[model samples]
Target chain A: MPVIKARVTVTLKNGVLDPQGKAIEHALDGLGFGGIGSVRQGKVFDVEIEGADKAKAEADLNAMCEKLLANTVIENYSVTLI
Target chain B: MKSAVVLLPGLNRDRDMIAALTKISGKAPVTVWQTDTEIPDVDLIAIPGGFSFGDYLRCGAIAARMPVMRAVAEKAAKGVQVVGVCNGFQILVEAGLLPGALMRNTSLKFVCREVKLEIANANTAFTRNYAAGQVIRCPVAHHDGNYFTDPETLARIEGEGQVVFRYAEGTNPNGSINDIAGIINEKGNVLGLMPHPENLIETAHGGNDGRALFESALGLPKAA
Candidate 1:
C-alpha cells in the first residue's frame, strides 16, 4: 500500500462573524495596506493514510472532515488530494 | 436530589462545581472522569467550566468526543437534567447535545467579570426557583462565548421559551446574540450557559444569587 496525502481546509461559514480575522484586517490597514475589503481566517490540516485506492481515501477524508476537522454547524470544509 | 459532576482533563472548574453541589444538596456529587464509559444514577449532571483540552480545535471540540461525553449524552437522552457551564456549555454544543456555536468574543479578548443575568424563563427545572424577568448576578469568564445560530434556530428557541437566561441591562460581556447567557434544550432537560453560576452560589462568594439555580435543579425547597 502507498501513502495517500490530502489537505483539508476548514473555514467559518458565511454570515458567521470572525473576530480574529477582523482584528488582523484592521492591523493590516493600520500598517498602510490598502484595498482590503474583508478578511476571514481558517485552518488547514495535512493528513496521510496508508491506502492505494483514491476513492477510499477521498471517502475517508470526507468522513474526517464531517466528524472532526470541521464543525459543520459553523464552519465549511473542503478536501483535496495531493 | 443526587447529582454528578463530569470531569475532563484541563477542566479547572470541576472542583468548584462539586463544592457547590455538595454544599447545596448536602451530598457530594459522584465524579465521572473523561474516560468513564458509564455514569451512576443521578438526578442531575453538571459539567463545569475551564479550558477543556486547552480549548484546542475550538473550545470543547475535543472533550466532546471523549468517552465520558458519550455517557453524558446517553444520560441526557434519558431525560436526566444536564447543565454545562462555560467550557462545559461549549462541549455540549460541540457534542451536538445543544444547538448553535460559541464563537470568539467580538472584542477579540478574554472577558472575566460579573454580569447580570435575567431569568428569561423560570418554568424550566433549572430556573424554576426564580421568577421570570428576575435579574441575578453571576460571573462570566471566557473568550469564545459569543453565541451565534441560524435565524431559524434563534426564532424557534425564542418561541419555545428555550432561551432561559439573558444578559440583562448593559452588561452583555461577549456580544452573544439575543443577549443570550443561557439556553435549554427542546426537551427542557439539558441546559448550556456561559456564566459560572457555581462561583456565585454562596455568601463567601459575595452573594447567593446563583444558589437558586442549583436549588431548582435539585428539586430542593427554595431558600427563604
Candidate 2:
C-alpha cells in the first residue's frame, strides 16, 4: 500500500492586516529590491498519512486544518495532495 | 471567596495570581491542572497569564483544547464567574468561552508598560467596585494583544454593554478596535482582558486599582 501526503497552507484572510508581511516588504525595499510587491505571510504544513486512500486522507487533513492547523476567524486554509 | 487558578504547561503567572488571591482573600486558591476534566465548585475561576503551550499554533490555541477548558466552559455556561488576564484572555477566546480573537500587535512589537484603562461598564461581578467610566492604570505585556472581531459582533457587544474596559483617551497600546481593552460574555459572567490586573493589585506595584476586580468578584467591599 502506498502512503498519502497532504500539504496544508494557512494564510490570513484577505482583509486581515499582516504586520509581519508589511515589515518584510519594507525590509526588501530597503535592500534595493523595490520591485517586490505586497507580501502576505502564511504557514505550510506537510503531513503524511499511512494509507493509500486519498479520500480518507483528504477528510482527515481537512479536519486537522479546521480544528488546529488554522483559526478560521483570522485565517483561510487550502489542502493539497501530492 | 473560594477561587481556583487553572494551571497549564508553560504558564508563568499562576504564582502571581495565587499571591494576589491569597493577599485579597486571606487564603491560598486551589490549583487545578490543565489535564483535569472536572473542577470543584468555587465562587470564581481565574485563568492567569503566561505563554501556555509555548504560545504555539496561535497563542492559547493548544491550551484551549485541554481537558480542563471543557470544565471551565461548562462552568461559565452555568453562571460561574470566570476572569482571564493576558494569555488567559487568549485562551478564553480560543476556547470559544468569549468572542473575538487577539491578533499580532499592529506595530509588531511586544508592549510592556503601564497603560490607562477606562472602565466601560462597572455593573458586572468583575467590575462592580469600579465606578462607571473610571480610569485605572494597569500593566499590559504581550506581543499579540490586538483584539479583532467582525463589525456585526462589535455593534452587538457595544449595544449590549459587553465591553467592560477601553483604553483611556490616547492610551491605545495595541490598536484594538474602539480601543477596547476588555469585554464580558453575553451573560456577563465571564470577563477577559489583555491587561494584567494581577500585577496592579498592590501599592508597591504602583496602584491597587486592580484589587477591586478580584475583591468585587469575591463579594467584598472595595479596597480603601
Candidate 3:
C-alpha cells in the first residue's frame, strides 16, 4: 500500500466579506509593502493516509472536506494529493 | 415544560440559561454534554451562547459536528421546541438545522450591548407572549451575528413569516441584513437568535422584557 498525503484548502466564498483578510491587506500597506491588491486568509489541512490508489484517496479527502473540514455555505475547499 | 440545555466545551452561557429556565419554567434544564448521543425526555432544548471549541474554524462549525448535534437535529425534526442563542445559533446554522450563515459583523467589530428588537412574528411558540410588532430589549454580544442568505431564500423566509425578531429601526447593532436578530424554522419549533434573552429574565438585570420569551415557549402565563 502506498501512503498518500493530502492537502485541503478552505477559503471564504468570493462574495462573502472577509474582514480579517481586508485588515491584513491594510496592515501590509502600512508596513510599506506595495502593489498587493488584496489578501484573503484561509485554512489549510494536511493529512497522511494509507491508500492503494490516487482515485480512492481523492474520494476520501473530498468526503472529509464536505463533512467536517469546510462549511459549504460560506466557503469553498480544494483538495490536493502529494 | 421540561427543558434541556446542551453543554459544549468552552460554552459559558449554560448557567445563565439554567437559571432563567428554572426561574421561568420552574425547573433547571438538564445539562446534556456534547458527547451524549441522546438527550433525556424534554419538551424544549436550548443551545446557549459561548465560544464553543473556542470558536475555532468558524463560530459554530466544530461544535455542530459533535455527536450531540446529530441528536439535536433528530429531536428538532420531531417538532421539539429548540432555541439557540448567540453561538448556539451559529451551531444550529452550521449543523444545517437552520437556514443561512452568520457572518462577521459589517462593522467588523464585536458588539456587546442592549439592542431593541421588534417581534417580527409573535405567533410562534417562542414569541407568542409578545404582541405582533412589539419592541423589546435584549443584550446582544457577538462578532459573527450578521446573517446572510441568498435573495430567494430571504424572500421565502420573509414571505413565510419565519423571521421572528428584527433589530428595531435605528438600533441595528450588527448591520444584519433587513435588521434580522432572530428567526424561526418553517415549522415554528426551532428558533435561532443573536441576542441573549437569558440575561434579561429579571428586573435587576435591567428589565424583564425577555421573560415573556421563556414564558411563551413554556406555555406559561405572562409574568406580572
Best by lDDT: 1
Which residue runs does candidate 3 get wrong by more than 4 Å?
none
- Greater lDDT among 1 and 3 belongs to 1
Q: Candidate 3, what DockQ?
A: 0.57
TM-score of 3: 0.95
Better of 2 and 3 by lDDT: 2
Q: Go through the candidates in order and give each one's C-alpha lDDT.
A: 0.95, 0.93, 0.91
Best candidate, DockQ-wise? 1
* Candidate 1 residue-wise lDDT, A1-82, digit = tens: 6899999999999999888999999999999999999999999999999979999999999998898889998899999999
Instruction: Give one digit per residue, the lDDT tens place, for model 1 in B1-224.
Output: 89999999899999999999999999999999999999999999999999999999899999999999999999999999999999999999999999999999999889999999999999999999999999999999999999999999999999999999999988999999999989999999999999999998888999999999999999998998
What is the lDDT, from 0 to 100, of the residue B190 in candidate 1? 96
Query: Where does the lowest 10-residue lDDT sum fall in candidate 2 chain A?
Result: A65-74
- The full ranking of all candidates by TM-score, starting with the best, is 1, 2, 3
Model 1 lDDT, full chain set: 0.95
lDDT: worst 10-residue window of model 2 chain B: B200-209
Please write out the lDDT profile of model 3 over residues B87-154, one tens digit for every residue.
99999999988899898887789999999999999889999889999999899999999998877888
As a TM-score, model 2 comes out at 0.97
